[model samples]
Structures are given as C-alpha cells and as structure tokens.
Target chain A: MYEFEFVKPTTVADAVAALGEEEAQALGGGQTLIPTLKQRLAMPATLVSLTGIAEMKGVKAEGGTVTIGGGTTHGTVAKEAASAYPALAALASNIGDPAVRNRGTIGGSLANNDPSACYPAAALASGATIVTSSREIAADDYFQGMFTTALEDGEIVTAVRFPVPEKAAYIKFEQPASRFALVGVFVAKYADGVRVAVTGASEEGVFRWSEAEAALSANFSAAALEGLSVPADGMIGDLHGSKEYRAHLVGVLTKRAVAAA
Target chain B: MTKISMKVNGKEVSGEVEGRTLLVSFLRDTLGMTGTHVGCDTSQCGACVVHVDGAAVKSCTMLAMEAEGAEVATIEGQANADGTLSVVQQAFQDHHGLQCGFCTPGMVMSATALLKDNPKPSEAEIRHYLEGNICRCTGYHNIVKAILAASGQLEGAIAAE
Candidate 1:
C-alpha cells in the first residue's frame, strides 16, 4: 500500500473535516478498503478513521423500523436482530463466514455498492433510507450503478433506517469464490405494496424487478414467477454465470424469496 | 501516520502506522505478534481472524486505527499462561481438527467466540455459527466434532473446577 497520512478523528465533525482534505477516504471496517489498497486499486492521500466516532455503531429497533449504525458489523446484526427482522438477520448470518461478518460493516457494503452485494437488495426491499452526513437518500435512489452510489465526495453514510416490513426474505445464489451473490433477490410486502429488488445480476447494478413485484403483488407465491422473464440487457456477465443465467436466477430467486417471506 | 493504542492479548501496546496500515500488519509487524496471519489480502480468508472486544473479526480487513482502545485476543492468547492449551485448543488437537493449520488461528478464534456466546451449540448450530470462518482442511467435519467436544469439556471443567 502506498504511504498516506492517517487521521483518527474522535468525532463525526472532525472526521468529516478530515475527509474534506485532498483525496481522503473515510475508513470504516476496511473489509473492502484494505484489500483495495493492497491491490493498488485505490491510492488515497489520507485516511480518516471513523473508529473513535462512537455514533456510528449499534442497532436500534422501534415502532415498525430498524435503524442500524453504519459501522454495525454483519455478525452483530445477524445475531442480535432475529426477533425484529428475521429475514435480514438470516441474510446477515449467511454472509461470508464469521470473520467477514465481524469485520465488514453494513455502511461500507452499502456505500461501496458492490453489484454482487447482499445488503443492497435488503435495503431496497425493506424501503430503507441511506442516512448520510449530508442528506438522506431513499433506497430506490441510493444505488446509482455498479460500484456507484448517490453519495457525494466527503459525505459519509451514517446509518441505514429500514422500515419493518410485514413480510420479507432474501434469497441468494452465492459465487463460490467471493461468496457474494451471483444472483440475489430481496422480496418484501408492506401496506404500500410489494417491492422486489434484484442484485448481482445487473451490470448497471441493483434495480427493482417491477415485473416480479407486480406478479407477487397479485399473488404472493412461488408459482407467480414461473413464467417471468428478466431481460438480459445490461445485466452483469461473469465467470460464475452468464447474464441470461443470472436473469433467470433473479426471477427464480425472487419467487423463492416471496414464497419464503 | 497515526498513533494507536490498544490492548492485545492483555498487553497494552501502541504503534505508529500509515493511514492504510491494516490491523493484521500492526499485529504481525510492529508488535511482532505473528500468530495472527494474513492468508488473503481480501476479507474472504479467515486466517487473520482475531477477537476484538470479545468478537472474532478479520484483522486483515480492518484498519489498525480501528482497534485503538479496543481489546484484542489472538491465538497466542488462547492458551493458559502455564503453557496448557485451552479446552478448545486441546479438542482440536485430540480431534485432528487441522491439517495445514494455516486457518487454525482464525478457526479457533471464531469457535471460541461462538462457544462463548452459545455454550452448548449443536453440530448444526456449530456449522452455522462457523460459516464465516473457512477451513479448507479436514473438510470441516473434524472441526465441528472438536467444537462439540470442547463445548462439553469446557462446560464440565467450568462446573468442576
């Protein structure tokens, strides 16, 4: 890794100020940043460590909503959130073994917006809000594209607020290498309507599968998605599976998710 | 560079490191605590797993500064000061839970944390709990057995002495 100035800020204001410096990156869990640094994929001039900022940790569940701190690890979420959000807890429990879950933060995952990530679909399906230092972004508008987000530079995601859904489930076809979703679907039904978010299949990144949503809305069953066709256009194609296969998996997994929910 | 102070293996240690210095690097290099190994630079490998505030975490993927003021426990701290192994470690030895041992430290740390949280975990529960800590050796069959045995032994020992 290239040599860079390190600043451990004690507060969010200090961290944000440090991040405003030239080419500074906010260090969360470093589950992704450290690897990127080692591979020379990212070479920032400074790193503003957020560890000292106590505000960016823990989970809170209250009247029909679950607010998780950005620094909350997957393991904590998995183990502690079963009663409030069973499907999300299950999803967190299944994330890259114990070690990854312990170190990888939810905010980092959502901020990085890895196309194959598991949390984005959950965030979207649950109608979560991306609470950043600057502004709150709705889940539908937070993820822009593959490895892209609505976050502006110097802005840090503080927390994710998920509205407790009446029913929700996440189904993932994991890639053996990265253990990330080859094709993952998160299905949720609220008083508003049913929402289906597909991740790991789109080259353009996570997008709502309106067709699957429409079908499931009519009848929340596995058979509802039997004949659905997710277009292959702009879907990610990789060694794990082809775009068409991923598209097929999305439909199938969405059905499974809905049924499971 | 940043100066970080943390307790590792019950010892308070401090270090000066670059912004990108990983917690694994600080443990392995600055402190010369080489028991924590970095198998994969990425977070995929659990070889760098260690306990941070009683939870097993991948040290390799975490910034060294993140550990400031946090309690850390590595494999070196698993055994008694008298050189006797912990029940979990003894169970691994008795059950042949390892082959290459590259993933042992991480596996042990993860199991320790799991058993701490759930004293009497079933085989299926053990497997599910350890899903994050990967071990290519022993096909994880023996590892599961060892955790079960250790769980029983630890409980017995705690009850007896």
Candidate 2:
C-alpha cells in the first residue's frame, strides 16, 4: 500500500467533504479496497474512512421493508435482518467468511459492485432502493456493471431498503478458492410478481433473469424453469469453470433458489 | 503518522502508525505481539484473525487507525487467567487438531468466536464456520472434533489424559 492520509469522519457530510479532497477515496470495510491498494492497483493521496459515521450503521425493518445502514457490517445484517429478510440475511451470513463478514459492509459491497458479490443479486432481485448521501437511487439503476455503479465521485451509499418478499431464497455455486459465487441465483416473490436475479456468471454483471421471473411469477416453482436456459455467451469463463458451465449452473442454481424459496 | 490508542489483550496500548500500516503490523511489529501470525498477507488465509471491538476480523486487512479505541483480542489473549490454556486451545491439544501448527492461532481464534456465537455447533456447522481458516495439514477432522469438544458436545471425550 502506498503512503496516504487517512481521515475518519463522524458524519456523512464530513465524509463527503473529506472525500471531495483532491484524489481522495471513500474507504469502507477495506475488504476489497485494501487488497486493491496492496496490489498497487489504485493510488490515492487521501482515504476517507466511512466506518466511524454512526448514522450509517444499523438495520431497520418496518412495514414490510428492511432498511440497512451502509456502514452496517455483514455480521450485523446476518443477525439483525434474519427475521425481516431471511434470504438476504442468509446471503449476508455466507459472504466470504465469519471474519470477512465482521468487517465487510453492505454499503461497501454494493458500491464496489463486485460482479460475483451476493448483495447485488439480492438488491436486484428484491428491487431494493439505495439511499445515498445526495439522493436515492433505485437498485435497477444503481448497478451499472462490474466494479461500477451510478455513483459519482465523492458519492456515498448511506443505506439500502429491501422490500421483504413473501418468499425468497439465494442459491450459490461457490468457487472453492475465493468463496465467491461461481454462479449464484436469488429468487424473490413479492405481492405482485416474482423477481429473479443472477450474479457471478455474467460479463455484464448482476442481471435480472426476466424469462425466469415471468415463468416463476406465473407459477412459482422449480418445474416452471425446466425448459429455460441462460446462454453461454457473455458469461464469465476462467480456470474455475467454462462459460458454458457457468451458464448451466445459472439455470440450475435458479431452479434450486426457486425450490428453496 | 497517526497516533492511535486501543486495548489489545486487555492492555491499553498506544502507537504511531502510518495510514497504510495494517493492524497485524502494529500488533506484530509495533507491539511485538507476534502470536497473531500473518501466514498469508492476503485476507484469504485467516492467519491474521483478531477481535476488534469483540468481533473476529482479518487484522492484516484492517488498518491500525481503523482499530482506534476498539478493544482488540488476539491469540495472545486466548489463554485463561494464571496462564492456563483456554478451553478451545486445550481442546485443540487433546484432539490433535494441529499438525504444522502454523494455522493453530487462527483456528483457535475462529473457534473461540464460533463457540461464542454458537455454544454447540453441529459438525457441519463447525466445518462451515471454519471455511476461512485453512489448515493444510490436519484435513480438518480433528479441528472439527476439537471445536465440538470445546462446545462440550463431544460426549465422553476427555479434556486431558
């Protein structure tokens, strides 16, 4: 890691001001950022630590929606959000490991937008709303691509609001090494319809499986997805698995998620 | 350099660290508390696991300044009063949970954290909770037994011969 000035701000306003400094970056749990810094992939003159901001740390559920502060750690979400949103909480509990869950924050996970991350699938499938320092962004518009979001420079995600689904479940085919999803699927059934999202399998990043959503909405069951399949094209292919394999897993995991839901 | 103060192993310690200084470096180099090893500098290995504010985290992945005013605990603190091995540590010894012993500290720390949350984790739960702490030698059978024993779930298992 290169030499940099670290500032911990107690408030989102102060954090934004600190981040507005020339070449300054917002530091979340550092689960991903610290590694990136160690690899010299990013160099910033200043790092604005966001963990100290108490206002951005908590989990609140009311009126069929669960709201979680951005700085709230995955460990907290796994425990706090379990009753309100079991599937999301289960997703939080399984991310990385116990230690990683202790430090990694939902805000950091959403902002960094790792293609293989679990939160993206949850947010997209649930159609959660992302509240930022400046404004609120719908999850549909929040995630732009892998490692990319609609966040502007100095913008910070303060909270995410998830509509509690009638029934939901996430199924992940984890890559042995990183524990990231080789192919993961989240199935959420709401009052109006069902939403299906796939992560860790796409080159374009977390995406809604609309066909599966439509099929499942019409009849929410694993049997409804028997004939549907995700195309191998645009899927991630690496030493872990082939693009075709990932596409196949996406279909399989989606069915599993539906069955589990 | 940032001047930070925190309680580690029940001791209030203060140090000057650079913004880039990892918490493990502060514990291992600044305080000379080397029990918290850094088997893999990357967060994957779990060798640098420690408790900051009473939760297990990868010290190597966290900056020293991030632990400001937080109560930190490491393997050095895992021992009981009067220097006896803690239950988890004693269980590891009785079960022969370690081989190379490189991953013992982390294993003990993670197991302690697990047992704190779950008093009697099933075999599958113990194995699942230990996903981050890798032991290349033990194949995790004894480690699982040690954790189960620590939770007092291993019926008729003796703590010492």
Candidate 3:
C-alpha cells in the first residue's frame, strides 16, 4: 500500500473538512478499500477515516422505516436490524463472512457500488434514502452503475433509510470463491406495490426488473412470474457463469425471493 | 510514519508505523508477535484473523492506525492465564482439526468468536460461520468437530453429520 496521511475524525463535519483536502479519500470499514490500496489500485495523499465518527454508527427503527448509520458494520446491521428489517439483516449476515461482516460497513459497500454487492439490491428495491454528509439522495438515483455512484468529490454517505416493507426477501446465488452474488434478487412488497431488484447478473449494475415487479405487484406469488425472463444481453459473463446462465438465475432467484417473501 | 498506541493481548504497546502498515504487520513485525499469520494478504484467507475490540476481524485488511487505543487480541493471546491451551485450541488438538496447520490460528480465532456469539452452534451453523476461514486440509470435518466439542455440542454435531 502507498504511504498516505491517515486522519480519524470523531465528527462528520471534521471528516468532511478532512476529505475536502486535495487527494483526500474517505475510509470506511476498508473491507474493499484496504485491499485496493494493498494492490496499489488507488493512491491518495490523505485518508479521512470515517469509522471513528460515533454518530454515524448505529441502527435505528422508527416511523415505519429503519435508518442505518453509514459507518455501521454489516455485523451490527445483521443483529440490530433483524427485528426492523429481517430481509436486509439476513442479506447483511451472508455478506463475505463473519470476519468480513465485522469490518465491512454499509456505507462503504454502498459507496463502492460493487455490482455484485448485496446492499444495492436491497436499497434499490426498498427505495431507500441515502443520507450523505452534504445532502440526501434517493437510492434510485444514487446508484449510477457498476463501481459508480452519484456521489461527488468529498461527499460521504452518512446513513441509509429503508422503508420497512410488509414482506421482503433476498436470494443470492453466491460465486463460491468470493461469496459475491453470482446472481441475486431482492423482492420487496409494500402496501402499494412490489419491487424486484436484480444484482450480479447485469453489467449495468443493480437494476429494478419492472416486468417482474409489475407481475408480482399484480399477483404476489411465484406463479405470477411464469414465462417472465431476464434478457441475457448486457449480463455479466465470466468463468463463473455465462450471461445466459446469470439471466436464467435472475429469473429463478426472483421467483424464489417472491415465494420466500 | 505515524506513532500509534494500542493494547495488544492486554499489553499496552506503542509503535511507529507507516500510514499503510496493516494491523498484522504491527503485531508481527513491530511488536514481535508472530502468532497472527498472514496466509493471504487480500483478506480472503482468514489466517490474519484477530479480535479488535472483542470482534473478530481480518487484521491484514485493517491499517494499524485504525486500531489506535483499541484492544487487539491475536493467536498469541488465546491461551489461558496459566499458559494452558484455550478450550477451542484444546478441542482442535483433541479432534486433530489441522493437518498443514497453516489456517489453525485463523480457524481457532473464528471458532472462538463463533462460540462466543452462538454458544452451541449446530454443524450447519458452524460450517456457515466458518465460510470465511478456509482450511485446505482436514476437509473441515475435524475442524467442525473441534468447534462443536469446544461448544459442548460435539455429540449433536456428530449425529447431525
């Protein structure tokens, strides 16, 4: 890893001020950033550590919504959000492993915007509100693409607010080596309608499947998804699985998520 | 270089480390505590697992500066006060959980954390909990057995298997 100045700020304002420095980067849990640094994939003159900010580390449920502090670890979410959002908790519990969960933060995961990550699907499907240090961004507009987001320079994701759905479930077909989602689907049913988001399969990153959402909203069941299929085009294809396979898995996992929900 | 202080195995230690120095490097090189091995630097392998503030985390992935004023525990701290093996370590020995022994430290650390959280994890739970800690040898059967035995659920685990 390259040498850089590391500063741990106790407040988000301090962190933002630190991050405003030239070549400054925000460090969350470092579950992904640390590895990237080790590989010399990125280099910055200063690292603004966000984990030390006490106010940005917790899970709170109120007003029919669950608000998760950005710096909150996946393990914390798994335990604390279980009652408020079991589907999100279960998704958090399965990310990487126990050790990874302890270090990986929801803010970090959402900030990285890894296409294979689990949080994006949940955020998008739940229509979450991403509260940043500067302003709040709707999850729908927050995720831009794989390894991309709507975040500007020095902007930090401070929290994510998820509306507690009546019924929700996330089903992930993990890529064995990394445990990342090979093809994952999150199905969420609200009082008004249903939302289905697919991850890992698309090269365009996590996206809502409107067709599946329409069908499921009309009839919330596995049977409602009959004859519906995701297009293989634009899906990610690698040694792990072909694009077609991922597309098929998307459909299959969506059905499973709907059924499970 | 940054001067950082932390409690390692209950010993308050201070050192000068580069901004990029990982916690495992601090424990092993800076403090001469080599029990925490770095089997894989990319954080996939659990050989660098350690307890940072009572939670198991990959030391290799965490910068030493991040552990400032934190209580860090590694494989070197697993033994009892009298230097006897920890319950998890003893069970590993009894069950022959290791062959190459390369992943033992991480496996033990992860297992100990698992048992702390779930006192009596079933075979499936143990396996699921151990997803991060990979053991190329022993096929993880003996490792599972050792963790179950340490948790006093050996009989149930064996029957389930």
Error of 2 at B108 (Å): 0.8
Worst 10 residues of 1 chain A by lDDT: A95-104
* Candidate 3 colliding pairs, count: 0
- Sorted on DockQ, best first, the list reads 3, 2, 1
User: Which regions in candidate 2 have their CA more than 4 angstroms from the true location?
Assistant: B156-161
* TM-score, chain A, candidate 2: 0.99
Each prediction's TM-score against the native?
A: 0.93, 0.98, 0.99
Fraction of the true interface contacts (Cα pairs closer than 8 Å across chains) found in each model: 0.94, 0.85, 0.85
Error of 2 at A118 (Å): 0.4
Better of 2 and 3 by DockQ: 3
A43 Cα displacement, candidate 2 (Å): 0.5
Better structure of 1 and 2 per lDDT: 2
The positional error of residue A108 in candidate 2, measured at the CA in angstroms, is 0.4
Model 1 - which docking category?
medium
- Clashes found in each candidate (C-alpha, N, C closer than 3 A): 4, 0, 0
Residue A201, candidate 1: how far off, in angstroms? 0.5
Better of 1 and 2 by DockQ: 2
- For candidate 3, list the clashing residue pairs, or say none: none
Q: What is the C-alpha lDDT of each candidate?
A: 0.86, 0.94, 0.95
The TM-score measured for candidate 1 stands at: 0.93
